[model samples]
Target: DFQTWQLAMYCRKAKLKLTMKSILEEYKCGKVRLVTMLEESDDPVVKTVKPSIKTGRKWKVAEAIDEAKECLRLKEVIGQTQTDRKGLGSSSVKWWSKTEGKEKRDMVIEEVRQREDVRRIQKAVQQPQQGQWTNWDSAMQRSLTWKDIWQMAPLRIRFLIRSVYDLLPSNANLVRWGKKDDPTCPLCHGRQTTEHVLSSCKVALSQGRYTWRHNRVLQELASVISTAKGQSNPPSPSFTIFTTEGGARKWCWRSNTASNQRKGLLDGCDDWEVSADLPEWDEHPEVIRRTTLKPDIVIHSPSTQQVIMVELTVPYESRMEQAHTYKKEKYLDLT
Candidate 1:
């Protein structure tokens, strides 16, 4: 029935007419539908038969109109579905598609493999070193305190220990090398080494003669012995010397009264005089004599008169000048 109406509409719109029976035969064979023919038809009869239009055997004219509306709605829904699916597609897919060839993809994969290999090698190398243990703890365990380390150290290590200890001390007097000031020993003009500066320096030794002489005087007075035999007694009048250089030396001495007097003055007298500290007299006493002076050593006299003084040009320029001026002024004042 729907096909019959469709054919009738088509023939009318084309300004041609065929029998209704032929149209009915076309409908039975499912050839056409009311909406299609209506859209195509221009005939007045077909337009007037719109109320009788049939879309299919199941749909009347009214139902066919509703079915047409449903078809349009389905088309709109399908169009919307296609748009949404386009939106959900991966952005990467579009970007990749724009690429000219497979060359870029292969390059990216190769770079990733190289990076992974490098990381794997690095991890393998680091693992062993990270797990390895150092002998630091065992070495530390062998010595308790730093002093113990120094005491037990061999000759080579002792020097290192001394240097380390000197640096750690609050009053350490380490020399700054390569300074503009003179580096020679002021007393003897010898090259200044640490030992020479502090202890064994010939200049210092010369300056210290008076002090050593005084100490000899005291040793005689005190009746101290250098060593005792068959008495199980340790040596007396023993001395320890630490040089600025990395060595220490010990000395023991015994003196008689005559030897004491020859070295300086009376053994027990507190009024012992040396070349550096002799008081001015109206006439120079024959008993008092000048001694050699050096400027790099402190001669400690441990006699009744214990004396300690530096035997060097003072290190600081400003202070040395000031001291020189003061001494000159004092001498003039005395004169």
Candidate 2:
């Protein structure tokens, strides 16, 4: 049956049975003949249908119609011309025929699809053994439709789709399938989850696999900041200083302006220097300080005496807010 085929398609996609209702609720196509029930008083066919049917059950259309007419009363009423006695199509209907309604329906469908994608992503993240993607954008998943998936090689399509749904033959999944006795990671001696092999292994981290990617991102950001407008060399310090006997020192900035007002942050700074923690490249930025804490990127303005530190993190979406908060607090004193 068509319904069975539809259900099978959803199952193939790893979707739940709840989607069956949505598939069956779309507009039905058949020989149109209706004028007995109107679900809403403001429905498009309200003016064309008989007043008795329109006013019969205004409060709760479905329940009232079910109780009164049983299987006879249609849920959605259709407009019919007096002479032809045929139901009017959507193009001829009033409120339902508006272009805004079509646009709004498309927007709602896209929003629902995005939410479903996010739900699937969160489910994958929560899978302890097979979890891999925790920071994927729902928009990217939503953009890949069945048409695109079908175009990929069959083996690739199966592998890619199975990976997303945690159905791949990973160690943990093999254990779940009764094919393996243990799911321990060979290198780290921890549960061999998909994420562990790809990103979270201590041995891999120690070998600088993750750091390589982190530094690559930092290098690009540092390059952008270095070439940004208003980034120039700072002028030489021009000030008068006095040291008291107790070793306390005081300094006054000497400016050409007669206003005697102080300049704001970055007000007179033309040169800004950019630095990053990456040291693998020949033209790598210089280390600004030999402190214990080193940020991913740093932008310093000598003239303004201001410094901006940037810390980059690639955390899971579920822990993104926590990571951001911790980073901000860690750098609060420096700021």
Candidate 3:
């Protein structure tokens, strides 16, 4: 079983057919050496080929083809003539011409590939060992095709393949394999699974490790918003101040609140304020409401009287929906 699973992984990585399916395809295409020789020879020994038995390498090409057809779940249909159809039964299996068979072969193989992919995913979902990947379908919004994988770096490719399959030697795996006596995390003494080590360690959370990482991401985002705000030009005022000629000239600056020249949040405002609730960061927007909610980042346009609040979250893939629901509920009153 281990060897079979290893071979399947290699085939998946290379995007190639499994051994049995490849052999079946070769026979169908008339490329198998034994089948070719059998079709060409007229000797008594060659004519004595029998059906394959369960436990031996010595098998006829026809038997192998039959086994593969069964494994792939391709049903056989028998043809019946109009006069024979009334009597109700047909013994002869339907056969396609060479040209038509090639097209049908491609279609059937394509369908087999799709079904194989679905089965592989379902098996992964049912596996209790890899609990982190249970919500793979929902977590992955966009997946890389073969074209994208081929261009990635070797290190990135290796990491992607290993991480997805839970092949890395985490503490739990080490203990399971008898390499270690303890499976608890070194920092928090919790079960040292991949998710715990990566994101949920209580000691790491208290030590501000997670917060530091979150702040780093938030800082980059704030910089981008600040740059865009600076580059945008603000709209002109709706009205200008007028003064009568006297001994001294007088002018005043006034903003028209009920003017129709207002633009969007980003436009009509040269002074855009952006703040982030990060440690050691000085720019933080003061909360006017009676609440202690500090969003990760805040963008405010005083000219348009508009404000936007952003919250950052980095959770395990399986817990994404739960985290989103919690955030929405927590901020429900403020919104």
Candidate 4:
């Protein structure tokens, strides 16, 4: 019920093979390992044998073998298998009995094959994998795959993610493996680790790399939104996203406006409504306020005297909720 008992299975298989070999050795026979024979036939070890004639003729056929032969003769070459490798895992159920008469060997092979197959299936069905719960395992689950990770990230970024997950060659890992000098953070000169470099380094955060990357993504998105807003007929539901044939997917909307109009396949977006006359979106456009608080981006609809504000936060995965809370508190007055 817990696991496939590999050791027990191997032992049982070994016992069965030993018994089978002893029984067949009395008759000079062996079970061929089919896969091994095919894969390593050129090896100098595998041997082959052919069956010889024992009978000469049938009573009804007098002239059938007047010279020497009568019965159906097949020049079948049977592989002479090694008894040293005989096990329950043997690929061949058939045996080379070194006899022209195959009846006894065939019957033995058929019975053994059928019996072993049923036993193997029953054992397989009864085995299951079980593991003890660990404190380090994640409670929050997200179904992410390699495709999702690799799709938009650069090769360096992909390698970085792999290294992060595998804990490969980082100072912390090197130290764990007892092969390290200094494990100090490159930027902050603190105890260097995967966590420090990715999230906890004050020097890195102070350098504003997080904000810079966040802004770059937003800027590209904003540009695309602005361009899409200008297209005729607005956007509709059930829109399919298509990228330019020869460029990055992010640059999909950068094609000529005239060509987009001709195709009329792409839509402005799912969550956004865009029109030249509806409203205006401005980036950090001097929000007149009692306090110095300003949104990263703003949507101004003059007719309704309303402003929809936006704030972008690019925090480490562990700090998303904290970042969200801070942003919400910072913009409470606007809301």
Candidate 5:
């Protein structure tokens, strides 16, 4: 009867049929105890010793022992209570105990203190009036001088003064009546200002192509310097436009007309004046005539001594086709 009961309990717990021989082998291996086996067995001889404890339609003793073992294994692995098992019809105990709660609160407070310290340091670093000439306003005040105001003015101040001169009639007119509302350029009928006249005016842009060319040349020069010396600190190129006899007359004529149009105390003066005269070359003097060039950009190349000349032209499709044909013909002639 004990053997039969053990086989029945084994079948119920394992959810598989257990032969009497397999049950005996497992019992000898000490996997199933004799007492547990006898308690869960359905044999009449075993039931007479202790009536089978049965809650109707609930887990049997064998099934309950198997579940308890599984729960214990899970608890060991995950450090959780068997009663807190999900989908098991059990209530949970609080996982976060008092000690865990205190540790979390301490971490939050430390993070807040760290954030406050960072903000305070940032505020100290960003405090204004901490250094002389640290900002644009202070730099301007420190750079201002009597010589700058009168004769050898800084570039920015000169630009501003020139702008005022171009806008108002004269210094006298400016003193008499702050500044005039007229914003027309005296040299051209375009809008007047340092930025507009020098950078964006159509007439100025046409004349400024030389500036782009000069920039390309400077870039090439820097590249050559870097290659030869194995150093990156190449000096910047100075842009100076020397007027040749051929272009000088034309420039003077234009300047005179512009002066006459303004007809004010500060009208007849040209803003751009260079002390150095144009270089003389008797062989090809007219071919190498001087013109004003402003540099738009500068870059460095890895090869060549003479800077590469890069001309930017927005040519029409027909003009481009003609240029291509001309080049092809020239190559054919050379061949």
Candidate 6:
């Protein structure tokens, strides 16, 4: 019985059936030979022969069920992997063989799992925590606002915000990517970061780029203001001074622009020396140490005895509201 059962298993595995017809065919016993000897006197002894093989329909049914199960399993693997029967990256492979289903399934499952792991890791890296941005100091100011940034042409400020400039290889990016031997800023020997590249680095500040940029605009504004004052031509902004007689001041610019322009654009009537009061923060190192109230673009008018305070800020477009509010509140009393 066990042998018969094992034979049925073999048949099922090979997609064959064991039955009387198959057994007869296997043994070459299906046909009986008719002897043609002269039979009047002697008849050959008849040999007993019979088709004895018999099998139930259950084996065939069982075979069908096994095949159906294999098909269902392959289908499930294909669905989970979102792969064709031929597999991924194989243009000429048209289909999979049932005999190697397990191997193919394992390969595709591993590929899908690896792909999912990479996707999850990427998502985690791309989106950072919302709290990291809170209470953030750009090393520039605590009062930075979006409106302040939009007050000027956006391209340069946006460049700073994006940190896209060609920088020294010592920066954080190259260091993190293992391209650089150091993560310290070459300019200041500080940790190189976006903030350091833009704002926090002392060496970058020492380059006088910030002052140069601010003064370029200031020179243009001074020229325009001079024109409005009916001094169609004025001295170089570096040393030019407007004298309107008043006890109070309206505006004053204190900068290092006085180095080289003394002989180029001086005017006979342009005053180079006048009394001015700077905002507390900018007055002097001594002033900042003494007072906390500070203003930007301070103006002193001796003729009217009045002080005009102006505040300027640069922030991203998104922080315009905060920038405006901070400056307005800071100067509300003077306004």
Best by TM-score: 3
Model 5, CA-based lDDT: 0.36
Cα TM-score per model = 0.16, 0.47, 0.55, 0.39, 0.20, 0.28
Clashing residue pairs in candidate 3 are none
* Root-mean-square deviation per candidate: 46.6, 15.8, 14.8, 21.8, 37.1, 31.8
Estimate the overall C-alpha local distance difference test score of candidate 2.
0.51
Best by lDDT: 3
Model 6 residue 328 distance off true place after TM-score fit, in angstroms: 9.5
Residue 179 accuracy (lDDT) in model 3 = 95
lDDT by residue for model 5 over 1-335, one digit each (tens)? 23223322232221222222343333322322443445446787885695444433542444534443454444456754452224543655322233243443333333333333344334423433111112222111123334545664467554443332233243333333456655566556665543454344577567765456445554564445334333323332233345777775332222233323423321222231111121221121221233233212222232322222222322222244454465455335325
For residues 197-232, write the lDDT of model 6, one tens digit per residue: 545578767897655554555555444543543442
In model 6, the worst 10-residue window by lDDT is: 31-40
The TM-score-based order of candidates, best leading, equals: 3, 2, 4, 6, 5, 1
Question: What lDDT, from 0 to 1, does candidate 4 have?
Answer: 0.43
Show the lowest summed lDDT stretch of 10 residues, model 4: 129-138
lDDT of 1 by residue, 1-335 (tens): 23223322222211122222234334422322444354446787766665344466653445433443454445445543333234653333212223433433333333333333344334433433221112112111122344654565476453433322222111212233223355565677765644344444665566775456545444442232112111222223334444555556544444443333433222333333332332221222232224333222222333433443323232222144555565455335324
Give the worst 10-residue stretch by lDDT in candidate 1: 131-140
Off by over 4 Å in 5: 1-178, 209-229, 232-335
Q: Candidate 1 or 3, higher TM-score?
A: 3
Q: Tens digit of lDDT per residue, candidate 3, span 1-335?
A: 34224433533322222233344333333422344355445676765764232333553445544444454444333334344124555354333332243444543444345444555546655656642354543464334556766788978865554555455577997897789999988898889987776688999999989888878888898888878888765676655676768737656657665354545557767777887786655565555233577777788777676777778887766677888888778788866
The candidate 3 region of ten consecutive residues with least summed lDDT is: 10-19
Return whichever of 2 and 5 wins on lDDT: 2
Query: What 10-residue stretch in candidate 2 is worst by lDDT?
Result: 24-33
Candidate 1 ranges with C-alpha deviation above 4 Å: 1-180, 209-335
After the best TM-score superposition of candidate 1, give how far the Cα of residue 150 lies from its true spot, in angstroms: 16
